[model samples]
Target: MTGCLDDLDITMVEEGFTTKDLLETLLKEASQRGSREAFFVADLGDVVKKHLRLLKALPRVKPFYALKCNRSKEVVHLLAGLGVGFGCAKKPELALVKSAGVPVDRIICTGPCKQMSHIRYAASQGVQLMTFDNEVELGKVAKSHPSARMILSLATDESRSSGCPSVRFGATLKSCRQLLETAKDMNVEVVGVSFHIGSGCTDPQMFTQSIADARLVFEMGAELGYKMHLLDIGGGFPGAEEAKGRFEEATNVVNSALDLYFPEGCGVEIIAELGRYYVDSAFTFMINIVAKKEVPLDQPGSDDDDPGGKKSFVYHLNDGVYGSFSSVIFNNTCPVPILHKKLSPDSPLYSSSLWGPTGDGLDRIAEGMDLPELHVGDWLIFETMGAYTGPASSSLSGAQPSRIHYAMSRVAWQAVQLLQGKLLPPEEEDQECTCAPLSCGWEITDTLCVTPVFAPASIM
Candidate 1:
């Protein structure tokens, strides 16, 4: 797959349609099928490219994809096929990865406090790599899986973490010695150290500091007569295009830190658990505008006293806080909207507030947005939605969570075939193919083909 794409000078394989073009096509198709709510369009080609980018930027570290980000089987299967490992935090996520045919060794069960049953199940399934930050968890592991390989998780600098996990997980520096001693006493193997700088991390220095902290833990374990070989740098990588500069900065810092702390041939294997970095920009969400209301506003300094002189528009969409927009409330996400139809520069703009379909007052999508006046039936699109969106959406208020539609460019499929060491069908060598299961509500063409896996009945 690398060789096939290395010869091509293109940044992204031409899928024969821009995002707007594909959005329009899908909107038309959804209208015909009577889909009143939002749906997702996943560009598998983009996802593959992101993986390549990660390899280029941080070549030394292997990434274990966090399934909590986007658990679509299609995404998981594609990553697994591409040789990416899986990071499962829950039993179901582990089951999903196992169902995708991922090797037991390629999966890591990563949660600070894991269920006893889950620990037993993982041990039974041959998943030896797990994480712990507290004494109780160590006790659980020692009793349930004595021979299990463990990674000690340390608390990161809270100021550097965007979504700080120190408050909930991670052992402090002062507590690391005691934990290692306990593990040594219990005869539980402490084979590595791990720390999360939090999700959506912005400070590159955080990584260097975390690495320094991990080094301390590594030395502490070594003093306890344990051979530490693994260093799990937990997830916090940003996945948005706007964060490219920050990501690069952080990657450079991580590379430098690895060289300084765990240099080449140091007998230490490095790995990362990245969630949003792999899939955030690979999806585009389209939501339908079901209703709208015009609110009259009075301008304090206007010569005309008519309240109608200034107006604010309220838009009601089929998906809301309980649905894909849950990220707005949960992740502190602020998704910007792109209209299906481009508005003229001279077009009138209004103060608009986008609302979710739910009756709850907190189900708002966006407030005080400046947008061209839109009518009912128009669509609002959100990008960089693949992370922490789909899996977190709920079916509250009778609003079904959005369905995912996977589309891979022709070049992407070729890359997949190359990576999997499979020959392209003779008939499909020069022509595109449209294949969809009868049960799915998709109309795929030759150029852009859809994967058969639809949205699961339940999300993460």
Candidate 2:
């Protein structure tokens, strides 16, 4: 069975197969039977379940999984199965989600740029909601699809945006008002007001500010005799763990803003489009170290004088910035990579930098971070990689993006069933034991103890 599962404390359902055990078995077989190059193991099912749980927890808010995050067909299909709507940025994403049998009504056509073909396709597909920032787009929609439904995105706190509305997205309050009035004149249905506070935002007040801005626009729309039918709070929610504080703060702001603007029974449909917050932490990247080396570091003097030298350990992994580490570049955060092989608790930790397989100078994933000195053939597992790691990192470069391997267990169910049956097996009474000689991605070269898949107490 998987020693990984033992560490994770997951019990398996199949006879003698703990979740880790199964992964171990798979890795063992794959190493011998499959390509050595990296591939992501997308546990499609687990990702969906986690998103569903988040959605359920956020009552009164619907999730429109940002398709720009991870566009994997498997991921899209799973989100569809979970009944989560999609926030599509372009034609391909729209096509991918639609191809998965997701009804057009369930998709929101989002994105700063709108090509004629994509917009026309969205209109023809009966997309219920699209966002626009200016009258030019309104005129385009009016010229192409007069009956298309759309949202007027209001620019909020330009000071907060790196480039503001000029970032080439969203219209100013004045422009939004003009756009809505134009929609009225052109017979286009202006359904709602939408705004984005940018991505990787952790402050809920930013959302509150956006909401307040939307409310002002709503009032403006009302003065112009328009009854907005929707409030599309565009994607910005953080993942369960990574963005928890931010999400909570944002939620409070949103709830208060909604109360202040449109109380319950206001007849306006409220929606939040979340991407990173919903999926980022639900996945992990498990990659094997293909090679390792000692690289020297140059220490430069504070001035133009002494350029003394420094030395540090560098571990090159299969995945890098061109792969799944783009989040580091974007989020200013590096995922924690834990060593899978056993080590002395007292062993001295070595500071090192993580690098990808690319020979390019910019291919470094992490630069000079403190981590255990690792060796070749060791496995490095980065947790909380579910969000932008997959689609954001995948490339037609050396070794395609890593594949995802999924694991889940009905621990509560097994416990309940065991109590009802009341018959304890020998495996249930035995002590817990895990495997040894661990390798990355779970290629088990040796066995230490026989792992019990199911034990009454353990399951409970």
Candidate 3:
């Protein structure tokens, strides 16, 4: 992969290879590849842009990419090369990060409760940074890995949390002093405090409150004769454009709170666990229409007469709720559809319902959607799917999973090349060169071409 990008000269974006252009090219390439099912088209360049955006928004906080979001090695390798840290909740996730050559200090083992084996493995690997929220977990860490550096996890105010984890994980504010004393008694080193406002948090004030609560805990740890140097602001950053405004607002509020509570020269190191922020918009899922059924309009006296008396179009796709659409059920994400080809302004629309290629009636994707008339063999795409989609997909009915096709825009590719030139070592440079042959590939300045590579499916 490095060799493929190294051949091109690092250049500017004036050549105009936008995301729309890349998607158009990828659609054509998919057809030529003889694919008749669902596939993924991932833009590595978009991940790069998201990292830069995070830096601009929160210069004081460092992000540790959540490994449970999308565990594609390509995504991890790209982020590792760009010097991003990682957050792992399980042993496999920690191993994957290590396989990408990320050092132990750059990876933090973060979960309220963890297995003893996981603790032993992390300790053996020199991953000392971990989180705990209960006495049982504290005892486990003390017995198994007594040298571990622990961060106490606290519950957030539920009214401010959008997707709350309080019931399952974090400790309450009233319980903080007792837990700190217990840790002191167990001889476990309590060096920090952590809390998650929630996933998809809408209240920026939640951040302000969480930080203030963390400050109180920090003072408590100090009173217990412990040095509190780290503050882990857990994950909740939104990644899509519709939520970008809210994300920015939250960033501003968080920035103000950090300045007030944990400003620089305060000797406190702040880090965040961000999952969807870096990869959500970088992925687009393309599903092929496998079958279609058109139901006749109900008559006035019909048994199934809808209020609008509209006909229903049922379309079956290769992917479903058990697969890439698992986020629909797990994260409550509703993916918007886009046609592969443009329709005229005057094209007629009809009531449509999309379903997965499964025997289960519950595998519906969309219902009562007003879409232009569609047919078998046509392709439908859903964007902003890079976050919780891939890692949640399963092979529940013996259905083979879909493959991923990775490509980058010319501007993004150039940015990667520039980074590689400066960061990568000489011997490790371009040890392998691989490319996918496609007719509609990206041509940059007529001197370089960008092709998509097929990545094997990984079952969660």
Candidate 4:
């Protein structure tokens, strides 16, 4: 009975009613009017910008966003606008980014299982830079495109991801040296050394340690008479405030480590591949709760700790593992729900479980999660759903995928209504504007006009 809902008040607000009312309002008046389902594929443009700002703040490291995170054309276009390149993990990703008008030179094609066709295409398109691990891969490149430019990807021990190279991509330090020797013998230009320290990396010192390992590789490359010019520090930067520590401090430590190990005048192009950090916080998924239940709690040491005893109610919402399986199973992330509409600070809190639309027991989104007791048809707004929640992720569930929507402009709703009246029917305009000038204080009078709210500097 006591958890996140411990402080919640059970009384419904007279003006607000319950979450059901708000969802019913939106469904009847808003979603029904639109063609797509109520669920949305949240946009990541703002989040991409935030990640770019963080990258730009770093002294000399350039970021190439890992495109596999989410390959929606809209998301790719947004990242391109932010001056970030694509870290393509597959052939299609390279093609997708290139088709968006991003220059070939700006793309880095990398993957352990890259086919010869993809390699040839990348080489022909002037995307000369790539990564390779084993001698077989090096031989494959040499046989197919002898003059291909490549990086020797080294396997680092700090990675915390599921695929952390027990036997996958990236050569060992010894293997890196051997691969470099093979590349030199085959006339391949080994221009860089790359390492991935893993995703959701909370330890900043891991980066410093990885840098030290990279420098040892650099020294090896140097001894082999091959002076590499690029050092790619692979991505793992956390997006959430809790997982991610102070930005400046982390970057400072990385820079300091680089300075201590990298010799001056080496002139290496420092690059990083960031996926989650860029698009993680840019969007939210608003789901409608379908059911609710509350049970009484029993004292464990007392005589009343029996099954089917009094317990707390649980709330079920649409979209579960099948829709956002990556965030749950792959990333092990818990989506925090925020009430869009205001609730009393003292609203009754309740222990709750969350289920997706399907009845499968494994379809649970959260269990024993705490929130204000959600009524059936109330909305659960999941924040930081931008990174991997999109149509591409919903392939297995095969349900109607979340409809993607966008709103970058800041024009007030009234102002947008005013502007569209001159061009088209009021009912036909679907674009929503977010603009609200601080100077005006949102006074809506006959003569009230507001200015645009474009960012003078890009959003951080």
Candidate 5:
């Protein structure tokens, strides 16, 4: 509703249509062309659902979607239109969000270690909010972006219990005084406190402890003559529906903690950096099996038996760890494969491993899979691939990332529009239609705001 929706090339689908239907259509087209090209189908509707969940569950805390998770312009635009703030770690991400017509106030320049040029660029663009964790970072910010409103990045002491000090980021509690003093001496305005309890944290007590620590820091900032009005409890909520219970539990913990630590009418603005929670389950990655091999391991002292029966299969897919499945290497994500073709109810399962087309030993995507025999050109759909896969994908060794197709059901489109206060009077359902180029202007064909309208039917 805030940004222009006419520019987005979204495949408007019927209410009953799902991403699987769109993926099936594309897979059929690919098979017909004798092409084993891999691609992704992103449900923009899912993103809207996730955003609404955040607003409904944690009404007090605003969510700033980390662009590091997925910088897909379609997502950025949709979120912008929905009035979600952005957390950008670099200048390019800032530019990406800004290109979607996001205001500077809605964009916070994040990360402790930032380039001078990036700071200068953000300052030049009238971006005011930023975060820092050290005296050196404070000095840099004071020199580069004097008018910058800074949030101190506080590090949690979880490692004190876990006995792993090396896994932590941000400034320690003992050093908070020195950092605040240095910021004051330099005339740098330290506006608030922020902390990240790492990604994928499962314990709600960790968030509780972190929130308590932030309360201490906020008190410290106030004593040092800082306003300390903002508190950013960084994100680690699960992404997929299977983990919905955990997400709800975590939000409940966060809300209770906020009430106890920085209650309502406390004059402190609250926000969270939500990365995986927003996009991970929205995009489904589909890759074709390019090659397969029977792998055998030696059986010692098996004089009467053949080792062939114990052999496992290694199937190479079009995209792998280096490309669309980079989360395998970075986040240790285990991608579950969904066969495009159905097998018999009693179909025997075989031990299988999956690798990439590049043939690099390090390019393995997944292993310990019990899948039926798959051949060349067969497809495997990997759901929840939207988190860190797309933006971090590499073309290393000619491993091209899958082309992305964006879509949303007509009902979902209407819901988001209505939620954003941009939906017009009631209208008929959108007919079966594909995507149009973003450069083309769209107008209303019926009573709705969108006109009745890809590679695989849509592009964003």
Candidate 6:
């Protein structure tokens, strides 16, 4: 945590310091400097809170922060320091967590279809906790990383949860036995069962069936003489303020299922690959409007949600689906931007469509946003933009990814340091999934120490 935190320029702040407050301060500085680049203000304290809350909710399960989500180095380091394991999908990801001082035993190679080189790399590093859903993958691991402790991935019925038709990944329940048998035949060690209910899963009951399916797989592994000691109920937990209720409901559902199937002291180590649940609400993105266009309602080939709607406004932002907003294309995310400053409550609203700076036609950010008519120099604020936004980028045209200014309260930094290697007990008797709220007070004489985000030339 020292080296990672040393290289990272995190701002040390007092209690009650928020992301918006930092953004407001930066906005004025940007005005004088004429800097229009998109950026993020990430509240590291919120991330710390979520990790503590997770331990309080599911005491039996270990959390492996998935690298594919966000993959911000600072976030990874913070979580690593707090004892969250890493779920690496590729070679570079493995290097990342390893560089952060994550032990090979604490990391899981979660990618199913791994390349031969990647497998060798993982093996060379002694990262033996790999996942495979099919015999081919198992065979590859047998030949390459024979010492691997593989987790058999069981497919969940994700149609109801993912909203889209099943985008399949894991092995089906019927296929589980055959896969386990094959692992035995190939002399590959199958030590656990894993499943992802799917990203953005709405139904918590979906996890119930997956847990049941995993239990059956565990039995099958036992039948095959495989020592199954791990059960991974993979990620789908909610993170937004609105999704707090759903997250709590999911906590109850998952905890009950684990209790019923993999009870306490069951000799099974449970782990979860949580990505978005830890970072979504902690980050706020600010994109500058670079260009604007006004098209008459009668114009042909113009995009409009309301037919016969008045003039349509199109605004081009500095970052788009090609870069930081890749979630727009991949996750079907429609980002509704919040104006940096609400200048007028009575301002006329118009049919506005937001597009990223990329010249491609598919680089649209949001369509049919009922926004007050804004100008080229105005700024747009977007929250819940942390997960899947940064990691999915294609980096079209070799443009630099936006910067993130990390901040945490002194209280939070100390709190996290104290709880680094231990899980704190639930303070509230009735609240099952919540951590004891931080009792913090601001010191009037405290000074804010920020990591340098702006270059000296830019500031001047």
Please tell me which predicted candidate would have the highest lDDT against the true structure: 6
Ranking by lDDT: 6, 5, 1, 3, 4, 2
Q: How accurate is candidate 6 locally (lDDT)?
A: 0.79
Which residue window of length 10 is worst by lDDT in model 6? 451-460
What shift in Å separates residue 349 of candidate 1 from its native position after superposition?
Answer: 2.0
Model 6 clash pairs are none
Over 4 Å off, model 5? 157-167, 299-310, 391-395, 424-460
Backbone clashes per model, in order? Answer: 0, 18, 0, 21, 0, 0
TM-score for each prediction? 0.84, 0.75, 0.83, 0.73, 0.87, 0.89
lDDT of 2 by residue, 133-181 (tens): 8777777777877777888877656455433333357787666667777
Tell me which residue pairs clash in candidate 5: none
The better candidate by lDDT, 1 or 3, is: 1
- Name the weakest run of 10 consecutive residues (lDDT summed) in model 5: 451-460
Best by TM-score: 6
lDDT of 1: 0.75
Better of 3 and 4 by TM-score: 3
Clashes of 6: 0
Write down the worst ten-residue block by lDDT for model 1. 451-460
Error of 3 at 76 (Å): 0.8
Clashes of 3: 0
Cα deviation of 370 in candidate 4 (Å)? 2.4
> Residue-wise lDDT of candidate 6 within 236-324, one digit each (tens)?
89877677688899999999999998899889999999998999888889999999998775553245563335667888999888888
How much lDDT does each candidate structure score? 0.75, 0.61, 0.74, 0.62, 0.78, 0.79
